[model samples]
Target chain A: MNMKLETIETDVLVIGAGPAGSTAAKHAAMGGAEVLLVDKKSEIGTPKRCAEGVSKNGLEKLGIKPSHRWIAAEMDRVRLVSPSGIDVWLNQENVHLPETGYNLERKVFDKHMAMDAARAGSQIMVKTLAKELTLKDDYVLVKAESMGNHIEIKSKIVIGADGPESRVGRWAGLKSTSKPKNMESGVQFEMVGVELEDTRAVEFYFGSVAPGGYAWIFPKGDDIANVGLGIINSMTSKNAYHHLLDFVRECKATQKAVSVEFNVGGIPVGGPLNEFVTDNVMLVGDAAGQVNPLTGGGIISGMQAGLIAGEVAANAINEGNCSLENLKEYETRWVEENSLSFQKYLKAKEYLLSLSNEELDSIARAFQGSDFERIGPMELLGKLVKVSPKAMVKLGKIF
Target chain B: MIISEFCMYCGECAGVCPRNLIEVGENTLKFGQKPCKNCQICIQVCPVSALEVEG
Candidate 1:
């Protein structure tokens, strides 16, 4: 298996074989373009840096079915705990929302996605770390180290599906750097033997326990869960790990939990970038900050961005015009679908970060006896204003 | 910048570096040749307190 590595040429080269890169490679290959997908890890998915929660509707929209193989648990309810220990429960019966989702086994799920791309005829490479990129007139030359062997890939288009710590975006001259206020330092522990109040429920804790963010318990099984928390460290000097340790010590859901694995990451909660495409290069997924600012979820949105970018890249290549102008269609389509909502989420998150523990408790108290089915967004905001008028001044910008 | 032994090589600091002066491999963290202007955004975003300014 030790063959001399040489220069490879393709129509599209996708870096990082996560959901975004694999999906992009599949779509681009389906469009009749030669595609190459690579990841730095020896295995596609291990040491997952996520809470592993996804909505059923999101999967359905992408034509993906929740298979038993990759689904760890089916979620039915959400429990939000306030600063003063008030519990607010939301389910489909009460909230009139779908409320059905899955906690995935990301390792299996990611490998399956890479297999899909391979079935679509895209070349797959593991242990391939992209080191640098040189932009030429017609193609970008990517210098990568594959399996301890130096190699170069020349492609008409390059899709950067790297995570938040993307190097490709910087190589392409994109403004992808995040400010301290816009980033959430996240840490999680996959623990077994946890005593969960509801095996099918996802739990969240707010206020001083997780300043400027929230602590979460995403159940993987009846007795196993990923207990985690994220924080905007600019708001608090405490790092995410210390905050999570405090949560594990005090939160009832994780009190009996015994840790098996630990993972840490940074989430770009600043919304999508202003420009994700340059001449012959495009950035998708966290590389472009294509994450929901409010909830800090990126998988679904990253896949969506990947699909759009892949299709556009293929079309541009087929037409023999891989310029920035030809690739702007991906940006336009993504903006049409997410820009407005993400902007609103960013604004709401900013406003929420300014709230105090007392304000959060008061807000949670307002929902204690409210009828979730009857309460709309405006109605809920009106109630929050009534209880905490001082904190509702910027309500207009959020909604 | 000094990366302590507490670093798990999670790459949080690499993402926020304005000068793109950090590189994260599977288990290794490397600083680029470019000079750091002490933005300290990287230090603030570390999930673990692994990075600190050099004394």
Candidate 2:
């Protein structure tokens, strides 16, 4: 046995220091629990993986005000480019962007959230990689390597905010339900010299170019943007990176863009895991797959879920009952708060995935200048019926 | 073993490779100086059937 290892105890242990993990740590500590948060990265959000867009109102609903330090740009409008290159402009009251979305400087944003959690009295350790964990019914023991030292942490409950791989959740023996079809492969380039139509509008391109997924151009300034695309795993026999390069070469705006940084990663399109809580373990964030399928957004939902999980975790520790039944409250509450929108959007994703390039073009043209603020399934189907009844019929059945 | 054209750039293969022999690059995969022991977990975990072993 290694006796030089340090042992610490806390009421809650959060793995990963991403936005979700920090939020969970903050709330749990505020609820009077001794919380410890850890991440393998030296910095929480370096080498950015996301397109860094957040719904303004959605952040407000979570009580988060975008700090100017991390707000790259504020967007009040968006344009959806169809396969045929027809543009559909959507503003407030019409699309998911709803009121507005903010392009973020994630490095600053993640550090701010993590610092906030530390201020709330949550102990944080960076460069700590969780290697193994054991559940002992009443408590859990997490084995990790910090810097060059071995450490053991004992906690009443563990919140798995680790991203898609979710080593902590898997170590706790929680089963996830993500399917191959429920995930996407994404590649992005933060490029300079990309022109923006509107300084406040992000653009989305939908067509065969992305193959069951979509491409995005979110501007950070008048001349710089994060240009990216996600492709369904089953879409083609070619590398997703190649498709993104093709996009950079083909798009008028990004054609001459000079790449500043590159990011490649997996995106979960699944709504949520069925059983996220095990004895003494509560899963949060990407570990629970809380990303919205249709929008391919995870940060807002993950933070919200983390908030709920932290409160529930502290309660379980206080109640001295970390049973699965007690932890089920987190699951029930998150589902209640998110199920309606998430499920509806997931169904919409399925409907959208079934469409072909031609059908997608027709749908985009039908919604051109749809003066409406927002559209529901029935309204969209009604419009599509005029353009392509065949698509309408298939979509109606799916919806 | 060889990688096919279906590499999606998800980079999961590089994470699971025991020998740390793979590096995901801007447009192509980079191999380390060491020879691969053919751990094949990269093949098993690939979602798109991009990796294959020659008979």
Could you tell me how far off, in angstroms, the CA of residue A136 lies in candidate 2 after the best superposition? 0.9
Clashing pairs in 2: A93-A373, A93-A374, A94-A373
Worst 10 residues of 2 chain B by lDDT: B19-28
Q: What tens-digit string does per-residue lDDT give for candidate 1 at A241-285?
A: 999998899977777779999989888888888999999999998
Global lDDT of each candidate: 0.86, 0.79
**Interface CA RMSD of each prediction in angstroms:** 0.9, 6.6
Best by lDDT: 1
Instruction: Give DockQ for candidates 1 onward, in order.
Output: 0.77, 0.14
Score every model by TM-score.
0.95, 0.88
Worst 10 residues of 2 chain A by lDDT: A91-100
Q: A94 in model 1: Cα distance from truth in Å? A: 5.0
Interface RMSD of 1: 0.9
| Candidate 1: pairs in clash | none
The DockQ assigned to candidate 1 is 0.77
Interface RMSD of 2: 6.6
At residue A63, give the lDDT of candidate 1.
73
User: Considering only chain B, what TM-score does candidate 1 achieve?
Assistant: 0.89
